[model samples]
Target: MLPCRNRTGKMRLGASIESRPAEVETRKTFGHWEIDTVIGKKKGKNAVVLTLVERNTDFYITRKIPAKAASAVNSEIKQLFSDFGKKPEKIFMTLTADRGLEFASLAELENESTKIYFAHPYSSYEREINERHNRILRRFIPKGTDINKISEEELERIEDLINGLPRKRLGYKTPEELFNEQLDLIYRL
Candidate 1:
C-alpha cells in the first residue's frame, strides 16, 4: 500500500505510530484499558468485535458490536464504560486504540475525565496483551462468524472465563487476583 498522509502531507504510517508515554500517562489502575475492534465477515459488513485490555493486570473485556464504523465503536465503548458506573473515575484513565476510522470519533466517546489516545495503525503488536486475549476468545467465538448474534451475557461469561484462567506472568495467579490487588493499591493511595 502507498503511504497515506495527514492534511499536512507528512506521511502517516497507518498503524505504525508509537505513543507509549500517552499509554503510561493514562494507566492509573490495573484496569486502565487498551481498546481495539476486529472486523469480521465480508468487507464493509456491519459486524465488529470490541476488545479492551487492562494495562496492569492483563485482563480483557470483549464486546461484540453490530456495526464496524467509528460511531458504532464510540457508542459501544461509552456504554461499556458506563456499565462500570456513571462516574468517570470508575472509567479508568487512558484508552489506547489504533488509528482506524472506527475510532476516529474518539473525542465523542470521552467522558469528563477520561482521556483517549491512538496507537499507530497495524501495530496491534504494541497492544500485545489484547492480542493474546483475542486468541483466547477465538476458541469460543471464531473470526468471521456473525458477531451480532452473541448476546451481552454470553460475552460477559466469556470475559469471566478468560479472566479466570491463571497466567504464568502473574506466577499462575488469575487476572481477578492481580486486578483486585492493583485496585486495592490504587485505593490506598
Candidate 2:
C-alpha cells in the first residue's frame, strides 16, 4: 500500500514508542495495551480481526471488524467506549499500535487518561504481546483463512477458550482470572 498521507501529502503517525513510559516495558502495571489487526486475504475487502492484549495480565480481546480500514477500526473503538462503560480510562490507560494507515486516527483518542504510541516502522517486536497471542489465535484461524467466514459467535468462543487457558507465565493462572482481578480493583476504586 502507498503511504498514508494528508491533503498536503505528509505521512501521518503518532507519538513514537520511544515516548512511552518506562513503566510500560516492565509490565508491572495494568491498563497498558498493544493493538493490531489480523487480516486473511491480501486482496479483498474481507473482514479483519482486531486484537488487543493487555500488557500486564495477558487479557485478550478479539473483535471482528468490517474491514482493515480506519473507519471500521474507529467505529470499533467507539463501540469499546460503551463496552468499557462508566470509566474507560481506567481500563484503557495507554495503547501501543503499529504505523498502519488504518490506525492513523487512533491518536485522537489520547487524553489525560489515555495515550497512544506507535512502534517504529518494521518493528513488530515492540508489540510482542499482540504477536504471541495472534500466533495462538492462528491455531483457531489459520493464516489466509477468510476471517469474514468465521461467525462472530465462533470468534468470541475462540477468544474465550484461549483466555480461559491457564498459563505458566502467570503462575498457572488464566488470563481471564488476572484480568478479572484487575477489573475488580479498577471498578472498586
Candidate 3:
C-alpha cells in the first residue's frame, strides 16, 4: 500500500501499482486489468464513463455512470462483477487504477482473488493501456461533450470499432480476436 495525503492532511492507505507481480507487466496473464474514468466537461451533474481494459487482450469494458462519485463508480463496478456470475475472480484477477477520488472505495472490489492497485500520484503511465483506450474513446465522445447526451448503443458502437481494430502489438490481430482467445482458455482451464 502507498501513503497518500487526503484533503484534511491525513495519510490514506492504498496498495501501489508497483506491488503488482511482474507477470502483469509482461502481459502474459489474461485477468489483470487497468481502469479509469472519462468525465464530461460539466463536472457537477454531467455523466462520466468508467472504463476497464484487460492487460493482455486489450478487452474493453466501458460503462456510463451518472457521475464521478465514489458510490456510483463502486456500484457500477460491483454490478459488473455480479454479471460475471459466481467466478468473477477468474475474469478479474487484478485491477490497476489511478488515485482518483472516484476510485476511493476501490478496495471494496477486492475478493479472495481479485486485488486493486493504485498508481502513484500524477503518474498516468502506470495505467497506460487504460489511458490509451480513453484517448481513443475521446475521438468519438471528444472533450467537453456531455456524456449524458450519449446513448448506450452509441457507446457500444464505439467499443466495437475499437475492438475490431487490429493492433501491431497483438501481431495485427484485433482486440476482439485476442480477447475471445483468452476467454476460451479461461473456460477450458
lDDT of each: 0.71, 0.92, 0.88
Candidate with the greatest TM-score versus the true structure: 2
Q: Candidate 2: where is the Cα deviation over 4 Å? A: 1-10
Q: Please give the range of 10 consecutive residues that has the lowest summed lDDT in model 3.
A: 5-14
Q: What does candidate 2's lDDT look like per residue over 135-185, in tens digits?
A: 999999988899889999999999999899999989999999999999989
- Which candidate comes out best when scored by lDDT? 2
For each candidate, what TM-score against the reference? 0.77, 0.93, 0.92
Tens-digit per-residue lDDT, 143-171, candidate 3 = 99999999999999999999999999989
Name the weakest run of 10 consecutive residues (lDDT summed) in model 1: 11-20
Score candidate 2 by lDDT: 0.92
Tens-digit lDDT string for candidate 1 (24-134): 544444446777776567656656789988877777778787787877887887787667544436446667777767877875555556666666656777667777788
Indicate the TM-score of model 3. 0.92
- Least well predicted 10-residue stretch by lDDT in candidate 2: 4-13
| Deviating ranges (above 4 Å) for candidate 1 | 1-31, 182-189
Q: Residue 4 error for model 3, in Å?
A: 16
Clashing residue pairs, backbone N/CA/C < 3 A, model 1: 14-121, 15-120, 15-121, 15-122, 17-120
